[model samples]
Target: MRTINRTDFLSGLVVAALGAAGLVEALRMPRFEARGADPFTVPGLTPGLLSAVLCVLGIVLLLRGMSGRNLTEGAQPSITQWTRASAIRTLFTIVMVLVYGTLLFGRMPFFYATALFVFVFTVGAELIDTERRLPAWKLLIGGCLLAGGAAYAIDFVFTDLFLVRLPG
Candidate 1:
């Protein structure tokens, strides 16, 4: 009786796949060991947990789609919109992520790489959307603050709490 949105159903499936892949990769990471490592302090702590969360959320989305529930309007973009999104914004984001993870993270100091990645990605994302038309200065400052704060938090969590030395 109810019409299930094909877009949500498909997107849900895609997200679920990505989550599953992340979970598998996380599982392959080194486990907690005897070198002052607690059960919760494994190298895979964050990634593993994050992947599990993603897997759960993706499953929820899949269920929502299958049940013919009204998924968020924004969740299902029009074909033209989707094309534009994928072509520009989404691709840029993917490239940024790859660059940060592969080229920056371990190569440079942790703080520098983290800050650069966050700031550039945030500012680029904001600026790309011509609709919002946010000022450059605001984007820069906000991006800087957000990147700095987030970088600091990540560093503190890894170094102080997890005792993981993110490559400096």
Candidate 2:
């Protein structure tokens, strides 16, 4: 039987590695204090759950890669398919967030910087894809809505209600 595409295998491996790293980091974090000042707080609530989910996803990807099973077997991806580029795009988002936090946005207001970063990154990623083209107008609108909503929600929860400082 034909093997899975090298790109798929590499992408799965990268995701699995990141997931494993995240799992390790999460495990190393200090234990949640359940008693003091609502230790079951917002920051504590979603990350642990998300970390677990990511670990499961990583295992699944690793298994798929090892099994040599094409994730899109019925609809084989073209050699020039956009998934590879999309993977790079996702990496870009991570890098952007890291840079924003460490270099620029960490000192600024979270809502403003995050909203702009989200819009720029999302729209730029769509624009950079030479294959499987998506329309500019649609990308622009979607990016705006998504970034706006995310900023609003984050601001409402962390800034307004909880009076917590979010990374700019």
Best by TM-score: 1
Q: lDDT by residue for model 1 over 86-167, one digit each (tens)? A: 5799799889999999999899999999999999999988778768677888888889999999999999999999999789
Residue 1 of candidate 1: its Cα lDDT?
A: 92
lDDT of candidate 1 vs native? 0.84
Clash count in backbone of candidate 1: 0
CA RMSD of each candidate after superposition: 10.7, 10.7
In terms of TM-score, how similar is model 2 to the real structure? 0.43
Model 2 C-alpha lDDT per residue in residues 78-133, reported as the tens digit of each score: 65566776778877878887877786587767777888888887787777677637
* Model 2 lowest lDDT segment of ten: 35-44
Q: In model 1, which regions exceed 4 Å deviation?
A: 1-81
